[model samples]
Target chain A: MTRRRFCATLALCGLAPGAIATALASEGHELRLGLTPVFLDDQSIFLEAWRTYLTARLQRPVVFVQRGSYREIVDLLNQGQLDAAWLCGFPFVRHERRLRLLAVPLFQGRPLYRSYLIVPAGDTHTKSLLDLRGKVFAYSDPDSNSGFLYTQFALAKIRERSEVFFARTFYTWSHRKVVEAVAVELAQGGAVDGYVWETLQRSHPQLAARTRVVEQSPEFGFPPFVARSTLPAGDFKALQDVLVAMRNDREGKKLLGQLNLDGFTPGERKLYDGIASMAEKVANRP
Target chain B: MKHFMRDLSLRYKIPLRVLVLASITAILVTASILFRVYDETRNDLLRHAESMGRLLANTLVGPITHDDVWRAYEIINSPFQGGSLDQTQIAETILLLDTRGQVFVSTQPTQYPMLSEPGRLDPEYAAIVDLATDRNDVKPSVVDPSDSSRLFVTIPVISEGARLGTLVMSYPKSLFMPRFVDIAQRAALMTLLALAVLLPIAWYWGHRMAKPLVRLAGCMDQIGPSVPENLHCDLSESHDEIGRAGTAFKRMLKELKEKEQLEQEIMASERLAAVGRLSAGIAHEINNPLGGMLNAINTFKRHGPDDPRTLKTLALLERGLTQIKDTVAALLVETKVEIHPLSRRDIEDTRTLVTAEAAEKRLELIWENDITEDLPLPSTLVRQILLNLLLNAIRAADKRVECQVYRDSRSFTLVVKNDGTHIEDEDMAYLFEPFSRLSRNGHGLGLWVTYQMARQLNGGIVVESEPGETRFSVALPLQEEA
Candidate 1:
């Protein structure tokens, strides 16, 4: 029974989604989240919070990159342009061999979140991913775990290709853009980050109210803090320690609260194995 | 499952069918919308991509015509350096090809001049450039061949309609997905939202549409012969076909009940008419015996007081007269016939009618008649009754048939017993009913006719059967002369 429960927990977290390498090869001590505009609606506050916390803990100057698509951030990370980044689990798993696990955020005390498949608020026809075939769709990022990878995996499970299954698909590079596009009827449906969607519901009620979640995927490993494999061991440990202990410290906790998170937990390699298995399954599908 | 469904009442069947049909319709509509939008969105994406390529070609036209490779390089490289055409949003590669189909400049440094032979360059792009250079058409063109994964467009640098050089811009297949994914995601979301809102409304509407039918079914189930008149069905008030049907059904039930009652009344009147016929037959039989009895009484009155030898004659006469009197009393029919005093000769004549038949059947006729005076009842009915009973007994007896008649001032009783086969219990239920043939096969009317005549005379007939003896007895209330 315990083993079954363990397996169930593993399955719930999508430990096996997929893995790919980031593009940027130039490496440095700069840490930036390839945050599409949606992630840093006000970049100053977001960048300040991360820079102050990381600079104080790492004893190194930390610069945050606020502009760029998720793919750009991944490319920079791959080319060693950025030292570390807050990246979605999709890219993290994609570049599993090249990236090191730093830490994952704890939201509602779980290191997990979901992908929400959304449609226009007033639409009364679609019910599942299968129903959205040949319709215009929005994805948060090509490299995003919840935003794009899960949608691909879902299509693969049914032996369908996104190009044929959907009429047109495009990445917004930001979870917020996906929501806005769907809400404004620029797109008929979208795959969005659950956390971002929830945050938008609270932060921008009117925008969030324009669409409804049609599907909530099985819980998956949260997008986490990722660093290149070439990072110094001591520096990586310092970064992990700073995030994990964030809830325990006054300044850290205050910063986390603003982000609607408790703190961070130790990176669990096992947490993403389920996503890897999913990636394998998607690869194996006809 | 199919058999079970076949048995399902329409109340459930209708809702299930409606839900199934509606669900199928919803699915079909969603699928149609999804595929239709998908086609439209993809075409729109392709169009948009082509337009972007054309716009890029237009921007690079002047530099190529001026033979400014460095300036053309700056134009393509500007978009990569935070310019309007962001690197992620547009062309992956841009090149300026000279009139000789030699690459003069490109965004990538390694490919500054032609790296590969002209044949190595994209064949479709080379072909378009060759066409523009040869024809001097110098038109911007978007060329997307189905076999290739990359999108390429060619724009010839025109100086006074003279082709100077060509600008080639290329985007990989991945460039199309971002916009397409965004649009498709929104379409899917909208479809789901539409289903969520419409399905429930469909169910409610189906229920409302089937409501009258369900109610009508309930009414049909409750209807019975004994259902009360006041059990109201107000569904008839509605101005619909079902309401009209309810009204028709209510009328049908009322008419059926009335017809059933009328049938029962007609049957009773038929039985009464049958009884009247039986009584008339009995009265006719008694008339002959009554005339003879009056003559015998007149003879006795003329001679009984004069002769010495008349005493012996009187004893024989009294015995014979007593036999006649008992027979008439025993054969008295029901009360619907007017009472006429019984003559002593009626029993004697009825016994005489059966005596030969009993003798022919080798059965002894034991006639024990006790009646000796006149009684109030017509002798004709009595005669018919006695004759029918005696004939039934003679036919049934193996050796003997006994007819016993007795009368008091208040009542007359007659019993006919035969030593013969016993009547079966199953057959006894309908023994006195009309057209009942219980073994003897005597037109199946003998006992029923006798019973009806007896009923008319205010008397009843009963039969008791044992192993070797069966007896039919009838009793009538005696009436005095009016």
Candidate 2:
């Protein structure tokens, strides 16, 4: 009996480190990527496919973390719970001290997009934001550049406060939701991301056909993928390389096609100067 | 409706009644099954919604307690995102209300903003607030307010000791309609299929059942006051009710024919008796007066008439008296019953009497005599009956005349048949009446005399004529010697 017990002990000792190593490998190499509502809401399948692609390319496990609003994703990123996040330019610039830009999504062959001011299809007379006084308005998110900051800056330039210009306003927490609000006439006017609206037009034409775009803002830096500044350089570089080289790979190109994107670029910080200046102006308004 | 049905023919009425009854049963069964399906579906949907509301309330506890409006909003919106559950949207809107009955986080934030009173959004929301705050455990209820159609289910979010909030989910009532319609359609289809199979069977059975009755009715239509002897009713042998009716009708017709024959026989005999009494009185009165006149004329010729004129007058008077006596003798038929029993020779003598007429007509005479002994019937009346029938048959026969004489213990029968033209139905009615004028070549008094003689002897004569031949049958009951 003593000999049998000794043999059993020897077998357990031999299997312990292998099990521990497998567990450590599975838990430590997983990358938790955060997605904000600025991305389309109905892209769970796309997200899954992209996660699989990323895991295969980076030689590690990957997971996607989705939140309703940009603020939640930004908070998670700031708390170091997320390895990387795809966020709007406004939040990246606002928390530039703790976050570092990893990649910028290229739309229509350039890393720039625009914000739109939309109204119900029947509102023919409302050509610009000035004509929308006393009307209900919807905004995508406070941390959204094209969805929120651009509209605020435009209102500031006209010397009108948003609270006073519109009779009522509410945050929809999503660019697609902003379009939906305008389409359903829940809000007479709304601000949305042009790229998100265009993508929705392709995917759900009947829903997009309910609203009309009244104005398009000047081009601004697209929403970018970013990492926390404290992330290891090697891990950051690995994620950046995978994103930037997506156009050169077949699987990544197909995923990009589903996302309605051209490619990704390691963009410069000066590319978001227009949004940064607009944010500063909105904040410094009297 | 009763009159209408009574007037309808059995052929159409039977199938119509069966169809109406089957249709009523099918409709009732279909309605009941559809009602059950609707009830169960509604209950199942409500139960499913309640369970969903409870699970959502539990998940919202942490978010509601921490004041994470976005997380709570995302949790409520998750059910709307996936199309995996079903084609229909489960919930129209979901709301999270704070302990103060304020809208904390909602799927439609723009409509129901944070920290706003729930009642201000819509009047119907007041019911949800009341339900959430009224009891610790909120029950699901269908609330279709005037403006909107919705079914609301509320679940309270509670921690270890605190009630953090209420999770209210309102599903559009339209979602249950598709399931109800589906079940109703299936039930209706099944009912139609069953009716399709059963309706034809009912019709066939009804028609088969009504067929025999229709045939019996046709047979009844042929029956008149003067029922024919050869009426055919094929259904009498069957064991069904209609067959029994047919059997009864046939028996009634037979009795009617017999009664009609009896009445005809009585009329013929009564007429013959009346004629006999009148002729006998005439004969008696004429004979008495003529005898006296003749005797007086004879005495005058012998004693007082010596001139030529007196003699001529006497002779004329005698001739006139003799003519009157002879006319009266032909009219009188002897009513005396003869005591001599009928012999087979008497029946044979009829053939001899009609032989000359038959020879003149080129007719073959057939004689079938079965009797060898005398029968206790009057020979004179029997001889008269045989002579009248044979003479009539010889007159009417085309090529052949038949005479059959037979006797049993009770009666003597004679049958005379002639192959001649059939007797007309109109002529046959009065064929045996005196002076009928329906005979082919002679006065119709021969059959009348034959009928009278047969009746006097307590016998009957029946005539049956078709296209092929005419037959006369006389049956005389034998009497005891007096």
Who wins the lDDT comparison?
2
A28-112, model 2: which lDDT tens digit per residue? 6667788776667455557657876887788776656767678888899999999999999999999999999999999999999
Which numbered prediction scores highest in DockQ against the true structure?
Answer: 2
Misplaced by over 4 Å in model 1 are A1-42, B1-482
Residue pairs with colliding backbones in model 2 are none
Weakest 10 consecutive residues of candidate 1 chain B by summed lDDT: B109-118
Candidate 2 lDDT score relative to the true structure: 0.80
TM per candidate comes to 0.35, 0.54
lDDT, candidate 1, at B351: 84
Model 2 residue B458 lDDT score: 79
| Tens digits of per-residue lDDT for model 1, A1-286 | 1133234334422322232012112343444433433243343445455656766676555555543356777788788777778887777787888999888888778988888999989777889988887777778766777888888899998889888997656665578778876775646789998888888888789999989999999988888888888877887788788789889988888887777787899869888876777777776778
Q: Residue-wise lDDT of candidate 1 within B212-277, one digit each (tens)?
A: 777777777777756565666555457689777877877877787788766855565466556556
> Candidate 2: which stretches are off by over 4 Å?
A1-286, B1-37, B63-71, B87-89, B115-120, B136-148, B158-165, B180-332, B338-340, B343-368, B391-402, B417-430, B436-444, B464-470, B479-482
